[model samples]
Target: MIADSGLVDGLRPSPNFGERRGHSRPEMLIMHYTGMADGESALRWMCMERSQVSSHYLIQEDGGVVQLVCEADRAWHAGAGDWRGRDDINSRSIGIEIVNPGHEHGYRAYPPAQVASVLALGLDIVGRHAIPPENVLGHSDVAPGRKQDPGELFPWADLAAAGLGHFVRPERLSGGRFFGRGDSGEPVAAFQSMLAAYGYGIDPTGDFDERTRAVTIAFQQHFRPCKVDGIADMSTITTLYRLLGALASSPLAAQGGSRGAIRTA
Candidate 1:
């Protein structure tokens, strides 16, 4: 099969894909890690039709890039997830799987070579499709409660530095008031609102439920990587505020871009 991106070094088509629904083009880029002992195992699983999971591209630790599914087709990567209240993520996004022994096995820092390849390939996809910075997200970001493939160790800030994703410098960790699970108040509700507004799958409920903690952990994994304890510490809340502020002032926000679904296969 022909590769959708020139950056692809090999074509290893996976049968676990289908025609996109609701849209013909992808509007988001979902990143994930293999979460297996090795890249080849991950590739084989994704290629098997029974596995029923595939990503458009997979980058190995040595920087090799394999194109498993054509960009125009919808890969069965994101299972059940929502973003900004939109539940059809697979229909509107391209998925990339990075090679790594994820949390369960033995999560580690991504090798420099792999990261370089990811940056190049990701930039190519983002530039060609014009994917919004905010739309470039980790699997955890889209499926907070059930998924966390590309975990806190993933270098989101590096991607932001390369102009591939949205990010803001996290506030310094210090002593101050914070919120956590079981907390119920208008402040918690407002915090939830900000998370929802930023496209996280969350309801603005006044009570900080377990779902809120999961969402908070996801947010911290992506933004405040220095710490991700599922508790909304002073640093986490301040970092969220700063990130929201940054997004509000971004050019995309000014144009009133919809956070729902994007189409750019």
Candidate 2:
């Protein structure tokens, strides 16, 4: 098959993709690690119809780019996930699978070559699609409860440095009034509000339930990478506050939170 994107170094089309639903314009970009020890194995699985999984592109560990599905088609990479109340993520976003073992089979830090390749691909995709900074996210951000590929060692800061995604140096962690799973009250509600406001599929329920913990873990995974104990600590809150502030001051918020006020992070 011909490569969909000229930037792609090669092509290995998968039959697991279909027409995109609802809006044809993609507004998000979801990233993931192959979660397999070998790049060849990951490629084989993605190409198999029975796997029912594919992405627009997959960058091998040695900086090789392979197109598994066309960008216009809805690749079945994001299954049973949500973002800003939209459950059909695969229909509205581009998915890029990076080569890594992930958290299951001896999760390890991504090598420099792989990261650089992904960074370039991300820049190209965002430029072509005009995807907003906030919409670029990891698979764990969408399916926190089920996935954690592209773990903390993925080097989000490097991506940010190259002007690929939204990120800030997390505030230092320190002892303070923290919130955990059992905590329930206005504070918890406020935290939930922030998370929802930041596009996570959660509501301000005033109770730190299981869903809340999951969202918190997701938040830490994306924002405050220093810790992911499922607890809202001082660093987490401060980092979130800074992120919201940046958004508020960005050109995207020209209408002054018309989408939704920056109530929380």
Candidate 3:
């Protein structure tokens, strides 16, 4: 495949891509960590047809970038998931697989050079596509219950500072009313509504079920990395509220997709 970005250091075409559906161009960027022993193994896996998985780009631990699929095609990276009430994420997003022994092997911090490459490539992709800041998200954000790659250790704040994704200073943790699985009420429904409004695939069912917990954990991993216990604490709630509030002025607002105001009480 032809390289989509000039920043690509190499090319390793994979046969696991197809034409994009429902959308002509990508509107989101999804980040992931190769959950394997090493970068080579991860690369080979993506190139293997049997694996049934491929991303548009892969950033090695040493910062080398390999383009597996052209930006115009739909790579088989994002599995079953939805964002902003839309499905077929693979058709609407560009996927970047950052090399790291993820939570399975030996979860660790991303190195400096690798992170720099990610930042540069991310900036390029988002700029070219005009992807909104809030639309750049981690795999966990799209498929909360089934996956959590590019986990909590990923430097989301750093990327946000570098003008990639949307982020805010997380609220400080403190004593307050919190909700978890099995809890159901208007507050829980409100929280679910906020999550749904922010693009997560959840419903305002008024029940903090397994899906709610998983989505909460995903939100915390991406936004409130200080804690990710799947319980909606004051910190998580306030952080989400502020993040939604910030979206009013983001590029997404111009697209008529801005989230409605949510009450955090």
- Top candidate on lDDT is 3
TM-score of each model, paired residue for residue: 0.93, 0.92, 0.94
Model 2 TM-score is 0.92
After superposition, the stretches of candidate 3 with alpha carbons farther than 4 Å from their true spots are: 249-265
What is the number of backbone collisions in each predicted candidate, taken in the order shown?
5, 0, 0
lDDT by residue (tens digit), candidate 1, 210-245: 999999999999999998889877788778767876
lDDT of 3 by residue, 80-197 (tens): 9999888999999999999998888989999999999999999999999999999999999999989998999999999999898999999999987888999987788878877887
C-alpha lDDT of residue 101 in model 1:
89
Model 3: pairs clashing at backbone N, Cα or C within 3 Å: none
In candidate 2, which residue ranges exceed 4 Å CA deviation?
Answer: 248-265
Clashing pairs in 2: none
Per-residue lDDT of model 2, residues 1-265, tens digit only: 6675667888888989999998677889999999887888988999999999999899998889999888888999988889878889999999999988878788888889888888888998999899988889999888877887667787888898889888988999888677788888777777677677677888888888898888788888888877888887778877776677677344334334422332232
